[model samples]
Target: MRLVFGLVLIIGVGLAGFAVFMAKDYIGAYQAQLDAERAARANAVPTVEVFVVNRGLRYGEQLTEADIRPVRWPENAIPDGTFRALAEIFPDGEKKFRTVLRAMEKDEALMQVKVTKPGADAGVSSRLSAGMRAFAIKVDVSSGVSGFLRPGDRVDVYWTGRGASELGGGTSGVTKLILPGVQLIAVDQIADSDQSAPTIARTVTVEVTPRQVAALAQAQATGNLSLSLVGAKDDTVSDAVEVDQSEFTGETVAKEKEVCTVRTRRGAEIIETQIACPE
Candidate 1:
């Protein structure tokens, strides 16, 4: 019986020791997880705060840090709140966080592109830049003229001038297209002009180079000019006359077309007048 009791005691002690060992291991593992979490927290870089607000801004606008702020930040992540302040020290720039107002408008070419003194040496003028010598010719496109015509639309320009085909005639002179294709920079009324009602004049202004400006001015003064809505990115050049109309079509047609009228007097002295269309 004594030997059995001693064996039982040894088993009980062994079981207790095993349980203590397991508890120790469990505690160590839990502490290790805590240490790892603490180290991660220590190594974590504080997040910067940037806020976005809705403002109507033009394209290519230089953004400053003051333009944004973080409305919310993670707890204990930012040490001195320097991230929000750092944006101010930065110069005007473009960043992923910076938003544009007219991003969806998409008609950027209609927006006037001006070259300031600072922008002059930026190589923009050396290429496809619209400068002071350029001219913005306003063309009235009434009826279905303005339909499907968005800003930055490209078009082909045609003019009446002496050409080979005309020269072949007995008169030894021919009327032909002078300029075929021109880029439409803006499809809008001149600035500060009313464009709300159909009766109101809505002019489509196009930008042309100095030489082309002179040609366009002469064309506007002497010949009738019209616009074909070429809803395309690239300027298409062709001699084909898609729309054949009188050269000098303005934006709006007249309100009352006819001026003459026929009148008859009845026996009761009732006067009746019927307006007639122009012949």
Candidate 2:
């Protein structure tokens, strides 16, 4: 009887120890799962639905229902001038009536600068700022920066023409910088600044002030206008640039020869004198 009681007591203690170990493992697994879930929630980024282009759009292309759709964009990554609701952009059932000002790739967000006002198309007149005028100039393969010029590029305008000689002789050829940091608004009839490749446009339009318009008009009429491409971020004003034929050919301009002469006076009789002139 004593051996039986001892065996029963040992069996009960072993079962209790096993139950404790199993309970500890179960609790540890539950805690690990909860920690994992909390971490995932904390690392998640918030997103919102905003309209994006479903198809690539070019300038003057009309925006329709099929062209745009809503997609999830991170709230923190949302760009400015984006529309969150369709009604705000189209104003109730007018999706196919608006035009785009600039080109947009697929999935690109619609911004204020990329689109035109309601019921308006992309044109040169629409892009002009207040008190600004659009001036057009003739361009060619050589004068137009080898057809690499595009809208939104900056250019320096150089005028080449004949100017009256200071020596009162015939006109002399002259070339000088007339305008700098001028913003190009269009290449030919295309006002969009989103050109993918260089093209040779016959005409280029630039945005200018009224005073600049006058200057550019006279310069274009009197001389051949040439465009010089400026740096993308360049704001440095260049020094006065003027070049003449002598300067271009790097020839030493000659100075007039100095001469010496004397005047002869006669009493009641005029005397003729042939002598060297004074300097």
Candidate 3:
């Protein structure tokens, strides 16, 4: 009976030791998992909900609440003019909808500049600023930059015509820059800025001031106007640019010497005499 009791006590000690070992391993694994989760949380990027288009939208299309969805976006990477909430996008309570000004793809963030005001249509007038007017310029294949221009592009207007010569007497054919860095608001009645396909536009409308409109009207009436595409990211102001046929042919033009003459009027007869030119 004493031997059996000692064996039973020994067995109890062994069982307790085994239980402790199992508990230690389980606790160690749980602690390791908790540490990993904490590290992941610390490294996670902060995000915010932003409205994005659920499907492709084109110019002039109405944007409604059903066409958009909210998604988590990196807070630091959100684009400017992005709508953060449904109320901000639909402030009028769905009585009116905004029109798309530019084309957008699925999941693209809706921007303020990419849409028109509530109940407004996408038109050239919507793109104009205060005190600005829309003027159309005729263009052909050669003058239109081979049909590569779009609505949002900037261009330099070059006029080719006969003008008074710099040397003072006769007229000469000259090409001069009439307008620089003018913003195009529409191409052939299409105000869509996202038009990528090459189109042979017969006319392009530009936004200009009242004074500029007058100048462009005069230049277009008296000369052949051409367009030169400006780079999208270029902000450099163009200097005075005028090129004549003499410059193109690399030929020097000589100014004629001035002749001063004194005339005395006689009855029904006039006599002319050569005199020295004034210094």
> Which clashing pairs does model 3 show?
none
Across 1-279, the per-residue lDDT of candidate 3 in tens digits comes to 999999999999999999999999999999999999999999999999999999999999999889999999999899999999888888855545789998899999999999987778899988998899999999999999999999999999999999887755788999999999999999998999988999999999999999999999999999999999999999999999998878768766678788889888899889888899888
Clash totals in order: 8, 4, 0
Q: Rate the local accuracy (lDDT) of all candidates.
A: 0.45, 0.86, 0.92
Per-residue alpha-carbon lDDT of model 1 for 156-231, expressed as tens digits?
5555433332212222122345455555433343221112233322554454667877887887676555554454
| C-alpha positional error of residue 127 in candidate 3 after TM-score superposition, expressed in Å | 2.5
Residue ranges of candidate 2 with Cα displaced over 4 Å: 1-23, 46-49, 85-88, 91-96, 163-171, 192-199, 231-237, 251-279
Instruction: Please list all clashing residue pairs in model 1, or write none if there are none.
Output: 50-69, 51-69, 65-87, 140-251, 166-173, 166-174, 224-247, 224-248
Candidate 1 error regions (>4 Å): 1-133, 142-148, 161-167, 170-202, 233-279
The numbered model that scores best in TM-score is 3
With candidate 3 superimposed using the best TM-score fit, by how many Å does residue 202's alpha carbon deviate from the native?
2.1
TM-scores, one per candidate? 0.40, 0.71, 0.86
Model 1: how far residue 138 lies from native, Å: 4.2
| Better candidate number, 1 or 2, judged by TM-score | 2
